[model samples]
Target chain A: MIENAFYSQEKHGPYKLFSLGNFELEEGGIIPDCKLAYATHGKLNEKKDNVIIVPTWFSGTSKDYESYIGKGRALDPDEYFIIVINQIGNGLSSSPHNSLPPVSMQSFPKVRIGDDVRAQHRLVTELFGVQEVALVVGGSMGAQQTYEWAVRYPEMVKRAAPIAGTAKNTIHDFLFTQTLIDAITSDPGWNLGEYRSNAEVADGLKRHADIWAVMGFCPEFFNQEKWGLFGVESAEELVEGFLEPFFQMMDPNALLAMAWKWQRGDVSRLADGNLAEALGRIQAKVFVMPIDTDMFFPPTDCEREQQMIPNSELKVIHSLAGHFGLFGGEGPSYHGQIDEHLKALLAVPVSESIVEQ
Target chain B: MIENAFYSQEKHGPYKLFSLGNFELEEGGIIPDCKLAYATHGKLNEKKDNVIIVPTWFSGTSKDYESYIGKGRALDPDEYFIIVINQIGNGLSSSPHNSLPPVSMQSFPKVRIGDDVRAQHRLVTELFGVQEVALVVGGSMGAQQTYEWAVRYPEMVKRAAPIAGTAKNTIHDFLFTQTLIDAITSDPGWNLGEYRSNAEVADGLKRHADIWAVMGFCPEFFNQEKWGLFGVESAEELVEGFLEPFFQMMDPNALLAMAWKWQRGDVSRLADGNLAEALGRIQAKVFVMPIDTDMFFPPTDCEREQQMIPNSELKVIHSLAGHFGLFGGEGPSYHGQIDEHLKALLAVPVSESIVEQ
Candidate 1:
């Protein structure tokens, strides 16, 4: 696979690159020279009191979070140091798509959500000389990571904002993700991971897109606005309008790896295998903002999580854009909710001293 | 394709053979010695005012509606005469699967919802000597056929109940149906429509199941039950639980043909000159029941149709079973709603004048 520039100082950084120099993953695997792509904006104040961390979503990179980092928005670089880390298995980070030899499906690693959190921890504490993070904010798979940070290291994370995400994978979400993986794996051109040339699994990719298009919106949205569902005049337009963006720039293997991570995300599997206990460990001031129309991460699921953890508040984003509402723009226009939450978090006073154990 | 026993019943007295003889389709398509594999349990009443028509869902045989045609149910054999017509393209129903020189994908006829209703009309008006249907009821695609009966030949259908169905095809439904067709056609073993002797496309069949499993139920159903999302141990169970039945008995060609009909099932398109005027032509008393939790046919879609029709009632069947709640067996079951509606329809005083029009 061709390497794309994931971060540019002009756009995303003065960044730091961390390499494990061949480290062993928890799930009985080794990634030689395993690299974690990341970027940071603004300076870490004395005592690192104003440091904020935000992880990336599935197939999302550190750069994707840039819009939420800069200016007067949430985690404003001018007010607090913000760390954005590329998720493992995504293109810019270490993943099966770009990994050397042993490239078959069998060689793919089975890292869990805990592993992602652990890896991020190493990058923060060991490499960056950071001991505590004031807040961790994320959405979707990123939210999974934020939850992990709070639960896994209650002493380190003081506050968290997990937006439009879930504590565990829902079967409905899993089925959709699994179908996309199956579509890629079943393609004849997939060659069981033994293709000799640059063969693309066109049909499988298109089939994957077909699954995404249906679940991405409510039936009401399509009925109200028929023009956007599939394309008009010809099916080609429909295919182009929906499927092209997903497939044109995506690496099939990277997609599969992320899907595996998503399916394997089970924070409940930790904390003596009791999920609720693990959530209860979080000392952070928690804010769970689940998108109302996000079929994948419905508000009820978020509300359930909020009810489980102490000092947690549930913010329901009433929007019709479904899962993608977290990436606010003209369609969902969720800037108001995002802005309000950021203001509250910034305004709240931090505790002067940590309670000594 | 193995001969499906469900479609092996006799039609028009003597076992209807596959040669083009006893019946012909309205599309001008000829299937020599065409046979409709159907079953009937109820005896014709003395006045035949107790006749009830139940159409089959997608890929379903006349056998599907058998449970409701027993001795004590609404369509009891001792009281009402029931006609459960085997839809065309269902393997055993004069379909492409078992026909002589079996029809290839390219040669398969394009069947409209109207075609299925017209064929059943022939059986009702000619063989059974029934001038008007006491009640026409069905679910999902079956509901589509019931709606067509009332819309196409209103005078013949006295009352209609279309459950968990839509008046016009939505983009989401069209896309999903299209994916199913694509799964069958794109299978390498398909061999351009001549792979009958080779291995059936198991992968493709599995893909078809993957496409359907999500739409059949809600996220809560899967989450609360701890069903596997994917790659988890429960995935196999989940897949089998949802998809196996649909694929095990379905013929690839027949599946494709039926899917095409589903995709093109837009009654609005029938109004070549004027849309509103067409819906205004219907004379049958209509009841549109949309499953409250159905992702495929949201109740609001049915509400639009209810609003448009001159005389109609919109009912909601609330259940977490999603799209399949129309067939759900337990609490809030459609069976009770159906029974109540049947009683109401039977109670309506029929005007003595036959040719009021």
Candidate 2:
């Protein structure tokens, strides 16, 4: 299969790129000449103490997070050095759709959330020569990586806000992820991920979009006719106009690679499957923010994990858009809640948190 | 496409059959040599005042209701004559897999809930010579039929209890059902429902089962590890051992047929999309029962419909199993609630209900 420029910089606009030559994965595979696609805002201070890191979510690029990174926003470019990095297998980065042979396409390296954190680690510590991070925050799959960062380098991460995602993925979520993977792989056009074009797997990709239409947003969102806010008058329009085109344009194999890792996201692996022990190791002041209406990462699941971490609070984000509220579908109020919480998390004195730890 | 013996009476045990040669459909098509597969318990009293009707849900047969029929249960085979009828396209009935060439497989006529109600109407009136039915109760698609029966023949149905369903299929539910349909159709082996063997569409069926696993049960069921109660130790086993085997045993075309009709279940079509006006016509003592945790047909949706029925009462059934509570997955308390509600609905004097109406 030839690499499709479906998610390339030329198509989705330019972003900064870094090379991680033949990077080894936590799941025991290699991404030959692995590349990281990222975008930045603001500038690092002379002390490099005002640095912040945010990551991309499932099926998201560095560009999707632009909504939260404007002037006077929570991720204000004027206040902090903000870096929005893409996750491996998220098309813009080294992925199934764009990697070279021997370690490409269906053979692309399996990457766990930890692998993503470690790659970001090299970019932050080695490339930027930064020894401390002011904060690490993200939503969904991005949240999973944020938790990994806090747990993996507790001394370095002063504060963390993992939004709408669980550190230890639930069996329910695992099975849910399986259905998304099955949707694409089951198609004949998949051809073991050897298809010439995403159009070849159009039906399967559309099927994937259909699943997202149901589970990506909560029932009440549809019940309240909130898709009207998304510029769709009906459910059919929401699926075809908004959901279908976004997913159909992406490569199916890249999605499978990310899905496999998302299903296996569990920081508790650090403590031999003991969630409390792994979370107990975190020294950073953390905010476990989950969307109240999110069926994928319900607030209850997030609260349970928050209780296990010391100096952490469960911050519930109410949004009719459920999981997709990260994309502004939750209305203007959704972003208001996000900005308020991030501002508070940033305001907490770091020294006080260190003393408590 | 040849009819597999998968859902044949010879394979799933015998049921009485009724022929409606060249049966007409509500959706403007004909089901040639239409057959209704059903099972009856107890005898029809001389006055025919002791009859009870129960229709099957999607992917269910007459046999699946056996658990609720017994000497002293709500169905009470020893007292009330109970007839369980299978919906058209449900394997045992004349379906895409079983019908002859003129209108079989992909060409199977579209059937609305009203059509199933009409066909069952013939079996009760023409075959059994019964005019006044005592009670009609069902769950899910069966519940849709129950609502249709009450609306179509108001005087004939003395009491109606529609469990875990709504009179009008919500746009949320319509889109959700689309995913199930997409799962089967996207599979290349489906070949537009022309596959010779059900095994040819194994991946598609499994995908269907995966969707059911996520939506069929409430999130609490999975969060609390209730699969252990089902004799499965993990979610993987729950999907593979329980959900997969049940769906894999059925034909794809029949499932598509039922799913299509399910998506279009709107009783309001009788009064130009005015739900209140259509449900206001119900003359039966109605009991609209919805499971509190049910994501598909939540109590909120059912209560909205029940309010429109002048003589109806909203009965909430609490179950962790959600929609699957109909299949005993909600545990003993689930059936206990069903029995209690049905008994109360039946005990209400028919003349008093008529006077109230």
Candidate 3:
């Protein structure tokens, strides 16, 4: 007899979903109550001074960074309090997919990194009574959020580790994301972003898969192995393999909303009119690690940021894994280099705390 | 008064349309008796040795390049014969927009650079009785066609100049095109790629405009002189300004079809299945010039070709105009460099004549 495996231990996370009360969404739309999904893996010590902020990547949930959080890893839960907050459109949290009708694009709230960090800040301060974070760690879009936390709440974050991220998006990145989003919404079957099943939007998904496969690997990888990633066959098949499980698991509306958020992403917009000044206000020691093979967010873009933030260091990862190599690989794949840097970052003493001005 | 206002200059062009009895287009669809609209400037010399081929840019018509011809310019009609072939789905050419019913995504024939060059070859040999060309020059997608001409019919093309082009598309290019196509076909009003003028489908067009605006200019251009290419104050306004004219200019079906063709473009797919052999077979002298700020076709990609082709030269255009700078304003643009190159190219003895076989 098959046991009810649906309620497995693996599915249970460190934190549960919290209702933040009635909240106005966007475009003159409203949700009677908004729920924020989050997971915390480390214990908060007496002073609550060892917390670290970890935001979700685009299409990634709080579970995505789990590999880096367990025993002996750089962000080992045994040593620090790690808070992983789910961004608005991540399905488990507030999203268009689970929400009721009037579910048009306009109805979806306009969320930036600042908005995400702000909402997450409320959760940390009100519920956990967390005062300051030791570091904010993330990769890709998550890294963008980490940067946002430092800028938006200078007093709350003591250090930031933004990996494979950008200061201001290059035209190429904007074009890439815009295209991916367009592919999904353009399907006649999409019915104006209303189609939620894989059946209706299969073509769009296939096209989306094709684009993703290319961005997730390096040119050298393509030259050597064609389209195979680890051991996949074709670019289409790779995306298919990934999306088959992912699309079914995800809320399509949440995916759509997150895509909309990604397209509008620009931390430079929040520079209080001056980007350099905003970056300067980042009291946290910033560590910008851009992956060399990451076509989505090139290392040069990170190098550009290294120059802007005064107490920042750039750690370039050399791997053919592209954007995802930051998390999904072995110790040698990225850890050795990252560990070396983290050890150095950990050694640096936290200077001048944010005195309540 | 109207007659005097519009000088009816002698229609000196043999700008005839080629009628295909029963040919398929590039969108997995067929067009019975398809006709390709084209314009020819300059006179075919007695021996037809002064022929120059100019393929149209993406979203551009044969008419857009008309100004570059005539008495002056590098492609002076007074000096050589110039052929401007309208790519399939440019409205005037046989496209889903104007075709009979069943105008959907599956209606277009899958076409690559080989198909385009092959058709142009027939037009040149059978229609114009042109045995050889002095030069084939094109920018962007047009450049891809020019490269195909050199690879497919090495003996026919004496010289080739591909500006802001790549030997093979990078994954980045693939993803961008994939996304653009997705945006066009995803709208519910798209009616499975059948929607012609539906308002819902118009949103896809807006998305396309948003993406297109990002690539059309450099960040410096947007930062320094925000003249608003699409006219609105901000990025959203800019997207609005762009889509307003863009969508109205062509049928959505045609755009989708065109994009499909572009996505399938691969010059290596031509010849006897060996890409290296195809590159080696190009007996024509080649000049591959990539613009420094060209976000779509990066310079490093073009440099890849420099290592492959034997009798080839790589020229880098340092311009802030991005892709368009390959065909832009005054002295520093690609036009100036192209003019100098053309003068040099004109002086080089035809490749066939260089070493009499």
Candidate 4:
């Protein structure tokens, strides 16, 4: 079988793998040898107080962060040491695509958002000897990790900006994620995660892209013929150019693994299913940013969750791009709002002494 | 090949077939012979003025309307001669599953919402010699036909109730329908719609069910564990009992055909791409009813279209069951509201004089 270039670290990034030796998953599974692929930019200050961790979203790699992390951007690598940690099951990391026999695609253990955070924590503290995270910010599944970081390690994370994600995966979201996973798995080519090549599951990936086209953007995005902005004339062209090619590059099992984690994202799992209690544990200065027209994570949902987080502020980003607004691919319109907010968030003075909430 | 019981009209209904020797589609396709399966309740009065026409929804048959039609119900069979016409491509009717070669399975031509209405118009006028329809009522895709019938043959339809559907398919609805169709076609067992048995595409059907579980109902319906009322212990059971089995019985290509019609449901095609002009042509006493919590057809979307129909009333059904609230299956709690509104709609006197709007 031809090796898939989509999973290769050399093509997508300047990622370095940190082996965890043996890692136990939160959901009672263990990987004999687990490794996390990550990329670092700029320089770590002498005091080690300039660290800002950005976890990768589903199907995204560390390389994809370049647009969001440059000079004068929200995550300016010139000023802060920006570490982009690729989430597990994203192919680059120790995932279904690259894991060994015991934890390979067919037997890969179920992972949680907490597991990714735990792995990132080990990489930050062990490899770089970082005592605290100056800020943790990301969008979509990255936003999921940002919330996990704030709730799991309150003392270590000083500030967090979770955009287009939630503290808990809503029932609506869980169902959507399940359908996405099922779409890939139902493909005969999947063969229960034992496909010989990515070509086998091409149809599944295409279908997965179709689902994203529907759910990923605001209705006006299509009704207003916004695909023209992306150099596409029709809905069919939008799917062909944007959605299909994007998802088709990734491994189906890897996408399924990440979707499973996304479906089970709930900080409250640590607090015995008490969401309010889980949210109350956060000590980070929270900026809960949600896109206004996002069908997946609506402002109403984000605002409700924000009200539960005692020290959190809700900032609604208005854009027709919906969940993709955070990526700023539609235009520079949303990037300006995001950069302004992050600058303000970084300006807030951190407390000298860390205390448990 | 084993005969599929699901496609047999004898086992599931009291349906009678009406053959349209040769039928042409709006989208430049022709079926050598077209047949529509339909069921009728009550008796045609001496004057034939007590006629109420009901069309089947997507994947639905005439038998499925039993719950919504009965004595003293919204569609009381005792008071009117109700003709429940199965939409073309719903298996029992002229569908991808039941049609002969040239228009069967792999070769079935694309159908539109207008085509189904056109077929129904022939059955109503030519077969029954019906001069006027006292009322035309239906939900979901049935509602789509209700709108088409009113707009296409304004003089024949005196009253119309289109519930949980819109005059023109919204961009969001079109996208959702596309995802659903893709889900089935992506299945390897589908073999481009030539699958040997229903078992071949079971996974695709299950995934389709999962999508419906998310978009078909309000989030509160699942969040509050309202499925418990149906005697299901968990969400898994709800999927097993309600969603999975409900869709598993239908043919994939048939569902795809209906979904294509649903995605392209635009009466504006008749008015040269003006939705308001198409809706403005309705001479019926229109009742535009939409469920409050329906994610697919939200009250906001329904209300906007309702405004376009110059002489129409918007009655929002407040129920957490969402789109399924129209089915009256949420323990009959929502049935009372639907009954009340439908009764009110029925009570409105039909004007004797018909004037072009």
Candidate 5:
């Protein structure tokens, strides 16, 4: 079995796993015994009306958002029950790293954002007995799932906040995702997804990190040496301390699987390749938050799609951190804005028709 | 010996090579014999006063600028004697693929923008007996050399246009270049710069191409399926027909050499890391042209440095093609703007001090 040190609760947790047996995917793939790891905070009220779902971003586990949750933050565990779910292929969940023979590494089936949303729907509706989600919010790939949840089950998600991601994977996003995957697969030691250790593909991981350094943040983030805030003095140190080592410990196949899903993130396929028609299905109150400096999903790109959703509003987050700003790393400047928006969103009463049910 | 099909004059030329014996690099590297492949158009005036030097961009040879040259275009070879020189390591020049053992592939020394300008300086002054250049112009890595020429030998370059590149490689540019190098190096078949054939590291080249897709152009370029203009229907076709196949023909070690030079493109290093002081040394009338939508060299980024150069003006090229706009690929829309501007610049009378010579 692949080592669990990278994903176990001991390393990055205070989370639990919920076994999702025989999970079927939209793209015609099946995992004999699938599982989703998640973490929750606060209580599910008698009405099951105060539950908020937060999905993890690419390569992130449920616990990665611990700082964003709690008493007075955006998720605000004190006011609402927050469920942070780990998307499949992220090591903590049903990933290639942990699955058995037929479903492991090279044999892992392709998982789509829709498939992840479908599995999370079961966990919320069946296990938690939640009739409606107060909000579904996330960033990057997590934001992809948020859009998926909103369109895939319009009634279940009362409100949605998809940050730094779009309803469909733009061709540019697909290209970026492909490069990330190629970075890993090109590693000779990758051995067609049967690498024995992460060390074997260190060069690939480093390359992947270097790509992130280019696209993950705005040019100002590096030009201004903003990594200095993290106590790293130089660009080389920023890569060494943060990017390189961060990906080095993770499974390359797991990342490739997530990238595959990310590249194919298009809800329009559900509505027969019509983006406007697919977005037309979203009945929930929506907030499309895009980082102003994000290379892949710039504010203009997000605002264009946001205009297609009837009840959606475009909120441009001016951030030097670029896409990574959604993780709240620069400071409370962004998180504070998110908290203010979410508080206002939560303050609005739910529709009486749904509440009566 | 490596095949020269890609660089041979018979295939893509009307060019010649000038060999310099035992050329020594400023950065402590030596090429036993350095050769620069270049092409010239039109006739040299009696005074040799109408000469324009155009350096090739990264991965580009002298012939690649064919579309942008000619009687009525930007360089306007008929009006001005234009010499397009290939940057070292770009197959046509003294590259890893064509050099003999000691300076081939794994043994090729790192080349810099300063070194390229220095070689071109010799070609003009020593070989052509040209005391002063009418203009020094280029884009991308070529643009980097444009800046280098203006600063290093300001007296030689009367005017300069550095398009789609900056005087210093921003941390973002460095990171992007690093990723490109890493992608090629990590390919198992690369065997530490000793690949047998281009097919050996095809995966790496494909990944490099994918990264270019993400950064080389604006999202609008791909979103509108602009590749369709090139007779390609889908993104996959764009990659297969254009990107992948384009890089597959080039030498990986040659690319790595260029990338190393690109990453270290900082004229500021000459002034003890004083960007303003370094840019202040330019005596040439400068036009810093950056593509409005370029991810790596946005107008804001270019404009910042442009402000530091005393005789400089910032020209933002508004094209959806982004950085590729410098290549004049989005039709006459961009090329027209370049022509209009270059015509105006050339119309200015030469400095009396230089004209008297």
Candidate 6:
């Protein structure tokens, strides 16, 4: 593994390249020169047992998640070795945009939540020599990774919090993610993801943002004109000023890659299509936190998954902003509520919460 | 007015053209040689007071609505002169696809619910001499027309039933319509509304269908897999077999124009931005029927408009199918409920329901 200094970390995140040579994917295909980008805060103790893993969500990066950690925060770096790993295809890592010519752009190999979890496991165990995870918590696609970690390595993950996401992607969500993919690919500017610049596919990117405008934010959010909370006077300004530009900055292929992974996120595959059996494998004290108004992953869907877990509780999050509340777009109240739940989850002694083999 | 015999009516609808010569659009520009396509059932009574108008919805034609008018139905053709008018830009009329070269395709004049109502007004009075309409009832974009007819000519429409749609489009609903527009226009094949064939824009139409697959159907509907009731084995079949093929058959330009009108639906302009005052002008006995789980026009949004209309009653339609329940997608129960409300609304004595002029 070729480890390097955290580059974008100075201004963006504490992101470092942990090269994995040629990494295999859950879907058929190999990612050449595969490296997982991650950011770390605080130092590992002598025992290397105080580590917390937070995988990044779709279109999210390690640097973007820095706001989630600080002194006295639930993910406080003061007493724990906190790591935020950027999932594959999320721009910062060995993504479609940055990969070598043989496996570049639209030709990039498909990724899965299992593949991301496998890569993240290698980084935590091999690089840091960590034997146990104190906590694994994340939201949306990140929450997807959290579930994978708990199910795949039940003994390793002591406690897990999967917020605003589902253990198994529903038919509705699967189709919704497909729309995101279709939005980009349908654009002539995308040119099948061969466009020289992101600007080339601005039309497709804008359409992609439009879908998010409708589904990412809750109806109550738009009905109540909560876009004003984001400091935008009108909904058009929010879509044009905020959502469009944010999506435009990213690569079309990268977004498509991540969307495919999200659509296929289902731990049920581990138990041969039995979701209940798959969730029962989780030994961690899991808090399945779903945003109350999340249009993508509603509380009802998350509750079904939580009921299957051995030691899990359904924690419904309050946020009119819906799915985007994972980004704290609705302000302190969204994060404040998340921190409270995480704080409570982290405070519980792991030894007592976990089940013994 | 150059009135023509019903053409597609044999296999499709009793569609006859009513020429409006040169119709002015509310959004500027005039459609030269504009005509509205309509179908009629039963006959106009000598009193011309038994007339009922049912407007075609977005992407819907008068033919598709033939199911709503039958023996013993709420819209019983046996007793009433039922006119199902295809709204402007709805393809069957003087839409972008069929308009003259100067104002064809991309250059087609923008349409509004008011413009459609105006044309319908001309047809009812000048053609059929309908002095007082027994009722003006429809759903979705059709509901927009229903509101327009009631507010624009209150005395002409004695009863109005707007189902699964709002009188004034909410900011939330406005943005949702924008997504439908973005989905099509983003396609390279759309080529700025000059696609040689609908097949060229298959990708965009499929994406458009994908959005409907997500938002048009409620989460509860998907969670329970009510799609099975549609006779489809899987959700994928429903989207590909039903939605994709259905949308692909329509001209993208026509769909876009209707979406623009649907997004701008609001009666507040009539009362200088006072929605309450605008709706208050409605003298028709109104039954504001919104589907309980409609994601596009939630019952709450419809309830607000219902409260403003003097004789309006909020009749929430029960259907987990959401906005598309207007089409009776959830089966006989959906239509059964809608028919029940319409039956009750039609049976009410208009003298007692209407206010004195």
Question: Which candidate leads the pack in lDDT?
Answer: 2
Docking quality tier of model 2? medium
Candidate 3 overall Cα lDDT vs. reference?
0.68
Q: Using DockQ, give the best candidate's number.
A: 5
Across residues A76-135, which tens digit of lDDT does each residue of candidate 1 receive?
788888888877777666776666655333365766677778888988888768887888
The list of candidate 1 runs beyond 4 A from truth reads: A1-16, A67-70, A102-106, A196-199, A226-238, A329-332, A350-357, B1-33, B102-106, B197-199, B226-235, B273-276, B329-334, B349-357
lDDT of 6 by residue, B1-357 (tens): 111122245545658999999888888889998999998998888888889999989888898677687889988888999999999988788888777778878899789999999999999988987779999999899999999888888877899999888788988788888888888887778889887777788887888888998888888788898877666877878899989988887788889999999999988877888989889888889999998878778887888789999988998889878787766665678778878999999998887344436
Candidate 6 regions exceeding 4 Å error are A1-7, A43-49, A351-357, B1-7, B45-47, B352-357
lDDT of 1: 0.70
Residue pairs with backbone atoms closer than 3 Å in model 5 (clashes): none
| Chain A TM-score of each candidate structure, as shown | 0.88, 0.96, 0.88, 0.96, 0.97, 0.94
Interface RMSD of candidate 1? 2.0
Q: In order of the candidates, what TM-score does chain B achieve?
A: 0.86, 0.96, 0.86, 0.96, 0.96, 0.95
Candidate 3 or 2, higher DockQ: 2
Model 2 C-alpha lDDT per residue in residues A1-357, reported as the tens digit of each score: 465667867775558888888799876878878888888899999989888899889999888887787788778889999989999988888888777788767788788999999999998887789878888999999999999998888888898999999999987788789889888887779989889898899878988888888888877787788877688888778988989987999899889988999999999998899999999988888999999878778888899899999989989998888788888865568888888988899998885334324
Q: What is the Å distance of residue B71 in model 6 from its true position?
A: 2.6
Local distance difference test, each candidate: 0.70, 0.86, 0.68, 0.84, 0.84, 0.85
True contacts kept of each: 0.65, 0.63, 0.28, 0.56, 0.76, 0.67
User: What's the residue-level lDDT of A164 in candidate 5?
Assistant: 89
Per-candidate TM-scores read 0.89, 0.95, 0.81, 0.89, 0.96, 0.93
Compose the digit string of candidate 6's lDDT tens values, residues A254-296: 7888999999999998889898998998888999999988888
Model 5 chain A — which ten-residue stretch has the worst lDDT? Answer: A348-357
DockQ of each: 0.57, 0.66, 0.23, 0.46, 0.72, 0.66
lDDT of 3 by residue, B1-357 (tens): 001111112321335688765665443545676667788887899988999988767676676676466566678889999988877665666666555544423465555666677777877887889988888988888888888888777778888888887656665576567666666665556677655353547776666665566555555444444434324466545455554455544566666666666665666776545666668778888888888767668777787776688788888877766775644643434466777776676677874443322
Kindly give the number of clashing pairs for every candidate. 8, 0, 22, 0, 0, 2
Better of 3 and 6 by DockQ: 6
Global local distance difference test of model 6: 0.85
Measured by TM-score, the strongest candidate is: 5
Local accuracy of candidate 4 as per-residue lDDT tens digits, A1-357: 236787775678788899988999888989878989999989999899999999988888898777777888868888999999999888888888788787887789998899999999999999999988999998889989999999899899999999889889887888888878877877779899999887799888888888888778766676666776567788878888878998888889889999999998899987999999989988888999999878778777778789999788998887877787765776667787888889999988888647655
Model 3: lDDT of residue B10: 35
* Candidate 3 residue-wise lDDT, A1-357, digit = tens: 112121123653544776777655433445546677889887999998888788888777787787677677678789988888888767666766555545433355655565677778888898889888888888887888888888878877888888888756655576567666666666666667556454676666566655565565654554444444344686555456664445544444466777667666566677645667778778888888898877668776678777888789888877767776765653455676776676567667888677754
